[model samples]
Target: MKDIEQYLRQNKPETPDEGQFIIETNARLSNVEGIKGTVDAERHRGRLMLVIALVAGLVIGCLFTLFVVFFPVPSIETELSAFSKAIVSLKEWEALLLVPVAACAIALGVFLMNRKKEVL
Candidate 1:
Protein backbone atom coordinates (compact mmCIF):
# COMPACT_ATOMS: atom_id res chain seq x y z
CA MET A 1 0.00 0.00 0.00
CA LYS A 2 2.83 2.40 0.84
CA ASP A 3 4.66 1.53 -2.34
CA ILE A 4 1.45 2.02 -4.35
CA GLU A 5 0.86 5.41 -2.70
CA GLN A 6 4.44 6.46 -3.36
CA TYR A 7 4.17 5.47 -7.02
CA LEU A 8 0.90 7.26 -7.43
CA ARG A 9 2.26 10.43 -5.79
CA GLN A 10 5.34 10.36 -7.97
CA ASN A 11 3.45 9.76 -11.26
CA LYS A 12 0.41 11.99 -10.68
CA PRO A 13 -0.41 13.89 -13.87
CA GLU A 14 -1.39 17.56 -13.84
CA THR A 15 -4.55 18.64 -15.69
CA PRO A 16 -4.83 22.41 -15.98
CA ASP A 17 -8.10 24.23 -16.77
CA GLU A 18 -8.16 27.41 -18.81
CA GLY A 19 -9.09 30.59 -16.95
CA GLN A 20 -12.37 31.03 -18.91
CA PHE A 21 -13.28 27.34 -18.81
CA ILE A 22 -16.23 27.80 -16.43
CA ILE A 23 -17.60 30.74 -18.40
CA GLU A 24 -17.26 28.88 -21.68
CA THR A 25 -18.91 25.80 -20.19
CA ASN A 26 -21.82 27.85 -18.88
CA ALA A 27 -22.24 29.58 -22.23
CA ARG A 28 -22.24 26.28 -24.08
CA LEU A 29 -24.77 24.86 -21.62
CA SER A 30 -27.00 27.89 -22.09
CA ASN A 31 -26.88 27.43 -25.84
CA VAL A 32 -27.61 23.72 -25.46
CA GLU A 33 -30.53 24.52 -23.16
CA GLY A 34 -31.92 26.91 -25.74
CA ILE A 35 -31.69 24.21 -28.36
CA LYS A 36 -33.23 21.68 -25.97
CA GLY A 37 -36.11 24.03 -25.26
CA THR A 38 -36.70 24.55 -28.97
CA VAL A 39 -36.62 20.80 -29.56
CA ASP A 40 -39.12 20.25 -26.74
CA ALA A 41 -41.45 22.90 -28.09
CA GLU A 42 -41.29 21.41 -31.57
CA ARG A 43 -41.89 17.94 -30.19
CA HIS A 44 -44.97 19.16 -28.35
CA ARG A 45 -46.29 20.88 -31.47
CA GLY A 46 -45.74 17.75 -33.54
CA ARG A 47 -47.52 15.64 -30.94
CA LEU A 48 -50.47 18.00 -30.92
CA MET A 49 -50.67 17.93 -34.70
CA LEU A 50 -50.57 14.15 -34.73
CA VAL A 51 -53.36 14.01 -32.17
CA ILE A 52 -55.45 16.47 -34.17
CA ALA A 53 -54.95 14.52 -37.36
CA LEU A 54 -55.91 11.27 -35.67
CA VAL A 55 -59.01 12.77 -34.12
CA ALA A 56 -60.04 14.47 -37.36
CA GLY A 57 -59.56 11.25 -39.29
CA LEU A 58 -61.57 9.29 -36.75
CA VAL A 59 -64.36 11.87 -36.67
CA ILE A 60 -64.56 12.10 -40.43
CA GLY A 61 -64.55 8.34 -40.70
CA CYS A 62 -67.33 8.02 -38.16
CA LEU A 63 -69.44 10.69 -39.85
CA PHE A 64 -68.88 9.14 -43.23
CA THR A 65 -69.77 5.69 -41.97
CA LEU A 66 -72.90 7.02 -40.32
CA PHE A 67 -73.91 8.88 -43.44
CA VAL A 68 -73.41 5.83 -45.57
CA VAL A 69 -75.21 3.51 -43.19
CA PHE A 70 -78.09 5.45 -41.67
CA PHE A 71 -78.92 8.50 -43.74
CA PRO A 72 -81.42 7.74 -46.50
CA VAL A 73 -82.78 10.22 -48.97
CA PRO A 74 -86.39 9.64 -49.97
CA SER A 75 -87.16 10.16 -53.61
CA ILE A 76 -89.76 9.29 -56.21
CA GLU A 77 -89.16 6.70 -58.92
CA THR A 78 -89.58 9.46 -61.43
CA GLU A 79 -86.50 11.16 -60.02
CA LEU A 80 -82.95 10.43 -61.20
CA SER A 81 -82.54 6.70 -60.99
CA ALA A 82 -79.15 6.86 -62.63
CA PHE A 83 -77.55 8.79 -59.74
CA SER A 84 -79.06 6.45 -57.21
CA LYS A 85 -77.70 3.52 -59.17
CA ALA A 86 -74.21 4.95 -59.04
CA ILE A 87 -74.42 5.32 -55.25
CA VAL A 88 -75.74 1.81 -54.89
CA SER A 89 -72.87 0.50 -56.93
CA LEU A 90 -70.40 2.20 -54.59
CA LYS A 91 -72.01 0.73 -51.47
CA GLU A 92 -70.21 -2.61 -51.82
CA TRP A 93 -66.77 -1.07 -51.47
CA GLU A 94 -67.69 1.47 -48.78
CA ALA A 95 -67.07 -0.94 -45.92
CA LEU A 96 -63.79 -2.02 -47.34
CA LEU A 97 -62.52 1.55 -47.50
CA LEU A 98 -64.00 2.51 -44.13
CA VAL A 99 -62.45 -0.33 -42.14
CA PRO A 100 -58.93 0.39 -43.35
CA VAL A 101 -59.24 4.12 -42.79
CA ALA A 102 -60.53 3.61 -39.28
CA ALA A 103 -57.80 1.11 -38.59
CA CYS A 104 -55.12 3.46 -39.87
CA ALA A 105 -56.44 6.27 -37.68
CA ILE A 106 -56.45 4.07 -34.61
CA ALA A 107 -53.02 2.67 -35.37
CA LEU A 108 -51.53 6.11 -35.83
CA GLY A 109 -53.15 7.36 -32.64
CA VAL A 110 -51.84 4.41 -30.66
CA PHE A 111 -48.36 4.67 -32.11
CA LEU A 112 -48.14 8.36 -31.37
CA MET A 113 -49.61 8.04 -27.91
CA ASN A 114 -47.27 5.22 -27.01
CA ARG A 115 -44.12 6.90 -28.25
CA LYS A 116 -41.07 6.24 -26.11
CA LYS A 117 -39.42 9.02 -24.17
CA GLU A 118 -35.99 9.72 -25.61
CA VAL A 119 -34.58 12.26 -23.20
CA LEU A 120 -35.12 12.18 -19.48
Candidate 2:
Protein backbone atom coordinates (compact mmCIF):
# COMPACT_ATOMS: atom_id res chain seq x y z
CA MET A 1 0.00 0.00 0.00
CA LYS A 2 2.89 2.36 0.80
CA ASP A 3 4.57 1.60 -2.53
CA ILE A 4 1.30 2.17 -4.41
CA GLU A 5 0.75 5.44 -2.61
CA GLN A 6 4.33 6.55 -3.33
CA TYR A 7 3.90 5.67 -7.03
CA LEU A 8 0.54 7.55 -7.24
CA ARG A 9 2.13 10.59 -5.51
CA GLN A 10 5.05 10.56 -7.98
CA ASN A 11 2.68 10.39 -11.06
CA LYS A 12 -0.35 12.53 -10.17
CA PRO A 13 -3.11 12.15 -12.77
CA GLU A 14 -4.38 15.45 -14.30
CA THR A 15 -7.91 16.04 -15.64
CA PRO A 16 -7.97 18.08 -18.83
CA ASP A 17 -10.51 20.89 -19.38
CA GLU A 18 -11.37 21.22 -15.69
CA GLY A 19 -13.25 24.54 -16.16
CA GLN A 20 -15.56 23.09 -18.87
CA PHE A 21 -16.19 20.04 -16.68
CA ILE A 22 -17.16 22.32 -13.77
CA ILE A 23 -19.46 24.42 -15.97
CA GLU A 24 -21.20 21.37 -17.40
CA THR A 25 -21.60 19.82 -13.93
CA ASN A 26 -23.03 23.07 -12.55
CA ALA A 27 -25.50 23.35 -15.45
CA ARG A 28 -26.71 19.77 -14.92
CA LEU A 29 -27.05 20.31 -11.19
CA SER A 30 -29.10 23.49 -11.72
CA ASN A 31 -31.43 21.68 -14.13
CA VAL A 32 -31.90 18.87 -11.61
CA GLU A 33 -32.56 21.47 -8.87
CA GLY A 34 -35.25 23.14 -10.98
CA ILE A 35 -37.06 19.82 -11.34
CA LYS A 36 -36.66 19.20 -7.61
CA GLY A 37 -38.14 22.64 -6.81
CA THR A 38 -41.22 21.94 -8.92
CA VAL A 39 -41.77 18.59 -7.26
CA ASP A 40 -41.27 20.11 -3.80
CA ALA A 41 -43.74 22.91 -4.52
CA GLU A 42 -46.38 20.41 -5.65
CA ARG A 43 -45.81 18.34 -2.52
CA HIS A 44 -46.14 21.44 -0.35
CA ARG A 45 -49.43 22.37 -1.98
CA GLY A 46 -50.83 18.87 -1.45
CA ARG A 47 -49.76 18.92 2.20
CA LEU A 48 -51.38 22.32 2.67
CA MET A 49 -54.65 21.05 1.22
CA LEU A 50 -54.56 17.99 3.48
CA VAL A 51 -53.86 20.16 6.54
CA ILE A 52 -56.75 22.48 5.68
CA ALA A 53 -59.11 19.55 5.32
CA LEU A 54 -58.04 18.09 8.67
CA VAL A 55 -58.44 21.44 10.48
CA ALA A 56 -61.83 22.02 8.94
CA GLY A 57 -62.93 18.54 9.96
CA LEU A 58 -61.73 19.19 13.50
CA VAL A 59 -63.67 22.46 13.72
CA ILE A 60 -66.81 20.87 12.32
CA GLY A 61 -66.51 17.96 14.75
CA CYS A 62 -66.10 20.28 17.74
CA LEU A 63 -69.08 22.37 16.65
CA PHE A 64 -71.17 19.27 16.13
CA THR A 65 -70.27 17.96 19.59
CA LEU A 66 -71.11 21.33 21.17
CA PHE A 67 -74.41 21.42 19.38
CA VAL A 68 -75.20 17.94 20.58
CA VAL A 69 -74.37 18.86 24.14
CA PHE A 70 -76.01 22.30 24.33
CA PHE A 71 -79.05 22.08 22.08
CA PRO A 72 -82.32 20.91 23.65
CA VAL A 73 -84.01 17.91 22.13
CA PRO A 74 -87.66 18.47 21.23
CA SER A 75 -90.45 16.44 22.86
CA ILE A 76 -90.26 13.05 21.20
CA GLU A 77 -91.56 11.31 24.31
CA THR A 78 -94.91 10.47 22.68
CA GLU A 79 -94.13 9.76 19.01
CA LEU A 80 -90.47 8.71 18.78
CA SER A 81 -89.83 7.45 22.27
CA ALA A 82 -87.35 4.79 21.20
CA PHE A 83 -85.28 7.26 19.18
CA SER A 84 -85.24 9.68 22.10
CA LYS A 85 -84.10 6.96 24.43
CA ALA A 86 -81.34 5.91 22.04
CA ILE A 87 -80.09 9.51 21.78
CA VAL A 88 -80.07 9.78 25.58
CA SER A 89 -78.14 6.53 25.87
CA LEU A 90 -75.65 7.63 23.20
CA LYS A 91 -75.03 10.86 25.08
CA GLU A 92 -73.72 8.78 27.96
CA TRP A 93 -71.20 7.09 25.62
CA GLU A 94 -70.28 10.14 23.51
CA ALA A 95 -66.61 9.75 24.41
CA LEU A 96 -66.52 6.38 22.67
CA LEU A 97 -67.65 8.13 19.44
CA LEU A 98 -64.37 10.06 19.46
CA VAL A 99 -62.50 6.83 18.74
CA PRO A 100 -64.30 6.55 15.41
CA VAL A 101 -63.78 10.24 14.61
CA ALA A 102 -60.06 9.94 15.34
CA ALA A 103 -59.87 6.82 13.25
CA CYS A 104 -61.55 8.64 10.35
CA ALA A 105 -59.11 11.52 10.63
CA ILE A 106 -56.15 9.14 10.69
CA ALA A 107 -57.54 7.27 7.72
CA LEU A 108 -57.96 10.51 5.77
CA GLY A 109 -54.40 11.61 6.57
CA VAL A 110 -53.03 8.27 5.46
CA PHE A 111 -55.12 8.44 2.29
CA LEU A 112 -53.86 11.93 1.49
CA MET A 113 -50.26 10.86 2.09
CA ASN A 114 -50.67 7.87 -0.17
CA ARG A 115 -52.42 9.88 -2.85
CA LYS A 116 -49.63 12.46 -2.79
CA LYS A 117 -47.05 9.73 -3.23
CA GLU A 118 -48.97 8.43 -6.21
CA VAL A 119 -49.16 11.89 -7.75
CA LEU A 120 -45.44 12.37 -7.28
Candidate 3:
Protein backbone atom coordinates (compact mmCIF):
# COMPACT_ATOMS: atom_id res chain seq x y z
CA MET A 1 0.00 0.00 0.00
CA LYS A 2 2.85 2.43 0.83
CA ASP A 3 4.63 1.62 -2.45
CA ILE A 4 1.36 2.20 -4.39
CA GLU A 5 0.73 5.49 -2.55
CA GLN A 6 4.32 6.67 -3.22
CA TYR A 7 3.97 5.81 -6.93
CA LEU A 8 0.59 7.61 -7.19
CA ARG A 9 1.84 10.73 -5.38
CA GLN A 10 5.01 10.95 -7.52
CA ASN A 11 3.11 10.58 -10.81
CA LYS A 12 0.40 13.30 -11.15
CA PRO A 13 -2.21 13.32 -13.93
CA GLU A 14 -1.54 15.71 -16.81
CA THR A 15 -4.01 18.61 -17.17
CA PRO A 16 -4.76 20.70 -20.26
CA ASP A 17 -3.09 24.15 -20.35
CA GLU A 18 -4.89 26.78 -18.21
CA GLY A 19 -5.79 29.01 -21.14
CA GLN A 20 -7.29 26.16 -23.17
CA PHE A 21 -9.23 24.95 -20.14
CA ILE A 22 -10.58 28.45 -19.47
CA ILE A 23 -11.57 28.96 -23.06
CA GLU A 24 -13.43 25.64 -23.26
CA THR A 25 -15.16 26.36 -19.93
CA ASN A 26 -16.27 29.80 -21.12
CA ALA A 27 -17.60 28.37 -24.39
CA ARG A 28 -19.63 25.75 -22.54
CA LEU A 29 -21.01 28.38 -20.14
CA SER A 30 -22.02 30.64 -23.03
CA ASN A 31 -23.82 27.76 -24.75
CA VAL A 32 -25.66 26.93 -21.53
CA GLU A 33 -26.61 30.62 -21.13
CA GLY A 34 -28.01 30.75 -24.64
CA ILE A 35 -30.16 27.70 -23.95
CA LYS A 36 -31.33 29.25 -20.69
CA GLY A 37 -32.32 32.45 -22.48
CA THR A 38 -34.29 30.56 -25.11
CA VAL A 39 -36.10 28.51 -22.47
CA ASP A 40 -36.95 31.67 -20.51
CA ALA A 41 -38.29 33.40 -23.59
CA GLU A 42 -40.46 30.41 -24.44
CA ARG A 43 -41.82 30.28 -20.90
CA HIS A 44 -42.64 33.98 -21.01
CA ARG A 45 -44.45 33.62 -24.33
CA GLY A 46 -46.40 30.62 -23.04
CA ARG A 47 -47.48 32.53 -19.93
CA LEU A 48 -48.56 35.49 -22.08
CA MET A 49 -50.63 33.19 -24.28
CA LEU A 50 -52.26 31.60 -21.25
CA VAL A 51 -53.15 35.00 -19.83
CA ILE A 52 -54.63 36.11 -23.14
CA ALA A 53 -56.68 32.93 -23.40
CA LEU A 54 -57.97 33.29 -19.84
CA VAL A 55 -58.96 36.92 -20.39
CA ALA A 56 -60.68 36.15 -23.67
CA GLY A 57 -62.56 33.23 -22.15
CA LEU A 58 -63.71 35.33 -19.20
CA VAL A 59 -64.89 38.19 -21.43
CA ILE A 60 -66.77 35.93 -23.78
CA GLY A 61 -68.36 33.98 -20.92
CA CYS A 62 -69.46 37.17 -19.17
CA LEU A 63 -70.93 38.61 -22.36
CA PHE A 64 -72.82 35.39 -23.02
CA THR A 65 -74.14 35.26 -19.47
CA LEU A 66 -75.24 38.87 -19.64
CA PHE A 67 -77.01 38.22 -22.94
CA VAL A 68 -78.77 35.20 -21.49
CA VAL A 69 -79.87 37.09 -18.36
CA PHE A 70 -81.01 40.24 -20.18
CA PHE A 71 -82.77 38.40 -22.96
CA PRO A 72 -84.49 35.61 -21.08
CA VAL A 73 -85.67 32.62 -23.10
CA PRO A 74 -89.40 32.21 -23.67
CA SER A 75 -91.20 29.77 -21.37
CA ILE A 76 -91.43 26.28 -22.75
CA GLU A 77 -94.81 24.86 -23.68
CA THR A 78 -96.01 21.24 -24.19
CA GLU A 79 -95.71 21.83 -27.98
CA LEU A 80 -92.09 22.65 -28.77
CA SER A 81 -89.68 22.37 -31.68
CA ALA A 82 -86.57 20.18 -31.22
CA PHE A 83 -84.24 23.21 -31.21
CA SER A 84 -86.41 25.08 -28.73
CA LYS A 85 -86.58 22.08 -26.44
CA ALA A 86 -82.84 21.65 -26.58
CA ILE A 87 -82.26 25.34 -25.76
CA VAL A 88 -84.69 25.17 -22.86
CA SER A 89 -83.03 22.07 -21.47
CA LEU A 90 -79.59 23.68 -21.75
CA LYS A 91 -80.83 26.80 -19.92
CA GLU A 92 -82.41 24.67 -17.21
CA TRP A 93 -79.23 22.65 -16.69
CA GLU A 94 -76.73 25.45 -17.23
CA ALA A 95 -75.82 25.59 -13.55
CA LEU A 96 -75.10 21.88 -13.35
CA LEU A 97 -73.02 22.00 -16.52
CA LEU A 98 -71.16 25.19 -15.71
CA VAL A 99 -70.34 24.35 -12.10
CA PRO A 100 -67.99 21.49 -12.95
CA VAL A 101 -66.43 23.46 -15.80
CA ALA A 102 -65.82 26.46 -13.54
CA ALA A 103 -64.37 24.25 -10.85
CA CYS A 104 -62.00 22.60 -13.33
CA ALA A 105 -60.86 25.99 -14.63
CA ILE A 106 -60.16 27.18 -11.10
CA ALA A 107 -58.30 23.97 -10.29
CA LEU A 108 -56.23 24.20 -13.47
CA GLY A 109 -55.33 27.83 -12.73
CA VAL A 110 -54.33 26.96 -9.17
CA PHE A 111 -52.30 23.99 -10.31
CA LEU A 112 -50.45 26.04 -12.95
CA MET A 113 -49.75 28.85 -10.47
CA ASN A 114 -48.35 26.37 -7.98
CA ARG A 115 -46.24 24.71 -10.65
CA LYS A 116 -44.79 28.07 -11.69
CA LYS A 117 -43.91 28.85 -8.09
CA GLU A 118 -42.22 25.49 -7.71
CA VAL A 119 -40.17 25.96 -10.90
CA LEU A 120 -39.01 29.40 -9.81
Candidate 2 vs 3: which has more lDDT = 2
Candidate 2 ranges with C-alpha deviation above 4 Å: 1-7, 72-114, 117-119
> Per-residue CA lDDT of candidate 3, range 1-120, in tens?
999999998898997569778888999999999989977876776677577657756775666556555555557655787677658756776875575467557756765885575477
TM-scores for every predicted model: 0.55, 0.56, 0.58
lDDT of 1 by residue, 14-64 (tens): 888678999999999999999999778767866776776677777776766
**lDDT (10s digit) by residue, model 2, range 1-120:** 999999999899876768688889999999999989988877777777677667767776676666655653555445656667558745755785676577667758875885667476
Which one wins on lDDT? 2
Pairs in clash, predicted candidate 1: none
Residue 23, candidate 1: C-alpha displacement in angstroms = 0.7
Clashing pairs in 2: none
